[model samples]
Target: MPRRVGRVFRPGSLADVKGRPTRNTVAGALLLLLFGSACAAHKGPTSNPRAERELASDLTRVFGAPVMSQGLWGVEVKSLDSGRVLFEHNARTLVMPASNMKILTLATAAETLGWNFCFTTTLETGAAVEGGVLKGDLIVRGTGDPTINSRNERAAAVFDEWASALKAAGITRIDGAIVGDDNAFDDQGLGAGWSWDYLQYGYAAPVGALEVNENVARLTVRPGATEGDPAVLELAPGSGLQAVNHAYTGAAKSAVTIDFERRVDQPILIVTGSLAIDAQPATRDVAVVNPTIYFAQSLKDALIARGIDVTGGAVDADDRGDLPAPDARRVLAQSQSPALREIATVLMKVSQNLYAETLLKAAGAAQGGLGTTEGGRVATRALLSSWGIPQSTYVQYDGSGLSRYDYVTADLIVTILARMFGDPRHKDAFVATLPVAGKDGTIASRMKKTRAEGNAIAKTGSIANVRSLSGYVHTRDGETLAFSILANSFTIPAATVNWIADLAVETLANFTRR
Candidate 1:
């Protein structure tokens, strides 16, 4: 490592479920459908009485390990094929689910928006383009397109394409501002019950209709040439925020430690601490403030970089008045995001929080309502109700489980699994999104070479003292199983809880009726 700190900043920063037969709540009712209808219709992979007892014993030992003694655990495992509850402990208790919340968010979105739904972001203008000059403000209207981010592409690729399209259309200069119309989503950016400390990290990024780069900017810090010299700093998407470097290089081979801070009322990020001259460069991503403005400014910079003349500066539509109505605008450029299935894959595979939130708001907008978190919640609640899953089983404060206020029962999670697994409309697309054990996604390195390896596909969740793993696995006898394991208030390391959960899954993968 040549100590390269190539960050985007001059200074920047960085569920449950259970089963069966109760009609008042959908959790149990859905279980009956997965089980009862199957038994009445035909023979499925029935659970063996002796095998169930052995599984109970194995799971008890796995969860009873001393590492889990201090934590509160909730788990449920049921056969989607046979419709029998294989194992459950505290399955109905409400617990914080972390990113597992994305499951519910994506499932509802897939149902509401359909598999092929795509988000369209457009560049519109109310004035004419004459003699290579755009006479008025160029507005960018977004419909909560999460794929506009640079998770796997250049930060300015989308904007650069738009500028090229403009030049090809004989538009070389803009006479007015480049305004961002992020009105599709509300002004509330941060999720409910999120801690203030999380504001500086990229994962706690704000949500907006015009979000770019996932509302995050990376900060890179490198050691100076010699000891006691000021540390070098850089930021990506450098148009938005400013960085104040207070860090210094230390002696060669010394330890590297750095801290980033942004005061409550300040617009600048102050980087403090030191890095050894020979140490590798460090990088971190930090959330930006007022993401709508960030998106507008970034687009403005991209246009300028592409040899386009921008006589005016970037502006957020919320800060301006006298804008044209929707019908009065003419589109100059547009970007269509990948379909919902692809978007949902990113959401589940990496557990992208902004994606979950963006999709939720988009769902609300698609339902003929303003795209607000409350509206999203209403849409999701209605969807859950339609499935007969009782609203009392889960309390969703935000699409991502990043909010500590979000809670759900193991029973509810399994119900979601069973429903998605059994849904003819979304089964393949839905299950394909989960991370595979010992193969891909967040759990790529877990359970390698074990019976669970490549056999378990699940969503993993973690936040503070909470840890969760819920998904599906196939047993040795070829029985398909849906399961959820949640551990909260644990004193042990999160890896310990994950180990126990992985062990439990491995145990399930090893089960055989013979």
Candidate 2:
């Protein structure tokens, strides 16, 4: 028989055909046992070990690429199912997060303040109201609610509501000027750490207790033809602000530099610019100096335009004792948002700086006296610490990540994401706020062809030289993954940074557990 290539075994017995012939059946069984052990050694780990290795290899290839040279970059990814780190690279390194800082602020708010939290704006009376007529001052108290003027139409609509309420109350005339009660919050309308240059722009407008139309005024410019002629500038409707037009006409080829400044005491509007008559209409939204007075004046104008008469102009706290109170108690109209969760979702998805700042102040006001950004920051930090997050990880100077000084690590963000996922009360709200890859928010243009496109929900951050992405991604194996990738001092352009973020997300989607 062709030298018996192998031994023939029957049940638990084996036959040895080699030089060492086995006279007993037990000897053959020993030979078979050795064969089985050798085969078992070849099979190790899990069913998908090879797949896991391939996925890891792909991630390393991208990270090690020459294009991504940087100051520091870190990535941390963990599986929600197994609670194991799937991939990690310097995950503990601290770096400037840019707009990604909003993630911390939003997460803190959602954790401390529930999803359904709503802000209240009350019309309180400093004096008594008798027979549908206030005997003293009318107080419109601001609890530091930031959603005061999210939209122009909404702001105008609110004024109409207040006007109707005043008319229905049968108070056609007022004995004193309307008083704006913004003392609910401190006088530090702007954050101490905010930069002066940012304050001059609309994005960095100061947060006030009595905010109207986002405490902004629109200046519409219509340039006059011919050289040396002045440009005509007009204010938007219901904008009780006055401007001194210092804009002059210049050569058609000359570019105009517009300058505007608002002082607190006198509140003078100074506009200086050189305009070419043929240029497109220029428009600028400048922050109002005193939001309380602006709102008071706007309300008075609206009421007067609606046929109601007022005896006095808008007044500050000093004239509160002399103003008449509301004659009737009617809600008139109430402006409510789509819930805190929805707001948070937008704020995180777009990295909305203003919304985050406003939410911070609102939280502080809810805790106690006047709402303030500093108070809000303190409260937010304390709340996070109580939730088991390390205080050192979050270096939040402002609600928005506009400040370059703000810093956060990928590891800290991952920790926060994990905690939020574990909490049943906050799980939905927190998850909903993250940007869906290739669909909406900042990630709308990212992760096009990977499993992460619709499955990965994260927040994006971008500045001059920094880029970051942090959130959750559900793997193909039904495992939820939490990850954060932060890159600083990136040598590539912003578009390239985004590409790297997209690539990392794609890699995570393809990751498989062994």
Candidate 3:
């Protein structure tokens, strides 16, 4: 038997109901059903289960091929809107993150130190001036700022300002040596875990409490005729650096090879090359073996040229207690830069190793410790933990991620991205620092033509055996998702690994939400 409410049939019509207005009741029931369905739809899709399975299949197929080598890899993708894990595989496995570790360092710095932080460099006198002849050393205090490099013209300007200040103080001569105060950091310029082979190269530029010109000298090489003749090695004029050239020449078309070795007994630069005279000039930027001494000497010379005579050679070490009192003086000059946020953008975008390392040290120094790798790690971890992120997952050795010892999981990185996306205070700064696919930074040539090509913004990591990509992507449906993919121990060349990673990202971009 069927019960019905209608206008025409008495048995099946609303009028068939004894003493009740069936039309009004039927209308109410219909409206209630529509409202419930609308509410369910408004909740949105929780997870794309089918899409997750397909993504897993794609990864297995790509890496399981006979030609592919075995490796530890992980991938995780989460929907930003629903906070659901759409896809995940071994997301807890820890592996070397390489340069990708810079993300953590930068994020911690931005949050803890604030983006407007700036470092200061100051000059102090050690003795009272009597008739323009000071009786003690001139102290240059370093605040452990790493931005003071040879490439920075502003640093040179700062040096000039110091000279002007001395002149204004009516001090024309010093009876003692110039002391470099580098006590802001530990004496270990290079970290303990860094490889010995890297020390001789510019890339291993030792971390210094007082860094000048990135603690390196530029040597321009011009090939000389005959194998025995010395190849012309020109140092930056007035750099006060002495070079011992052992470079030799060979026949044309032969490749040039350069090797440097740092002896435990004494640090020395050993140059060897077989470049031909007709070949292009080779230029090498070698790290300054002793940055503190280098800076002191250069400053001494500059001061001497300005009619301020230094009685002795420059010496390295702290002289805070020995400095004279500050006199009433107006600001002679000041150098300003874009806020810390903008500076961080360059650090992350270009993968600037020096900048990252320096910023970490600055944070440590701000937190009551001599700026060092260990100090920076402690400070960075504390910052991340304060943000409610679990610090147990990350192992940070150096800020640049140049060490093979640093390890971080993909899941943790994606977690960070998710937070930054939702955090109004840091959202813009963090996103702007990431490299854009097919446009800039490490991803300038990656993920071309896929939905992720122009829409994805990420940070890339690469080392001898590690390749990682992590960041955010805007989907076709206007949904922003966070993802991280880390591949390690691939037997193939880095180029091939990059190709596979790009493909994975493309698949994620094209996936349809169901």
Give one digit per residue, the lDDT tens place, for model 3 in 1-514.
0111111221342334467544324323322322223223444444667866776676566545454457767778887767887777778888888778888888778876787887665666546788988777777666655565543475667677778888887888988887777778777666545667676666677666676666766777777877656677776532334566788766667677644445555654566665676678887777666667767877788789877899977887643354444452223323344467866776877787767777788778778868777778888888778777676688888888878778888888888888777777877667777777665777877775556654577888877788988887755444567888888877788887777777767666665666
lDDT of 3 at 53: 79
RMSD of each: 10.4, 16.5, 15.1
Q: Which has the greatest lDDT? A: 1
| TM-score (all chains, Cα) for each model | 0.89, 0.77, 0.80
lDDT string, candidate 1, 43-94, tens digits: 3665479978988988888877876787899999998877888999999999
Best by TM-score: 1
Error of 3 at 438 (Å): 2.0
Model 3: worst 10 consecutive residues (lDDT sum): 1-10
| lDDT, ranked from best to worst | 1, 3, 2
Q: After superposition, how far is residue 20 of candidate 2 from its true place, in Å?
A: 80
lDDT against the true structure, per candidate, is 0.83, 0.67, 0.69
Runs in model 2 with CA error above 4 Å? 1-57, 126-136, 150-152, 235-280, 318-338, 449-451
Q: Write the per-residue lDDT of candidate 2 for residues 1-514, one digit (tens) a residue.
A: 0011111132332322345543223322332332223323433223465665676677666666677764567888876555666677777777888777787777667755678876556554544445655555555666545555644366666667766776676665555566676776676656545555546456666666676666776787767877888888887543445688888877786897767765445546677887777777788987655667776777667667887666677766644554334444333334444468867865787676667777777777767876777777888788778877787776777777777777787888788788777677777667767777766778777775556655677888876688889888755454567888888887677787677667777777656554
Q: Number of backbone collisions per candidate, in order?
A: 24, 6, 6
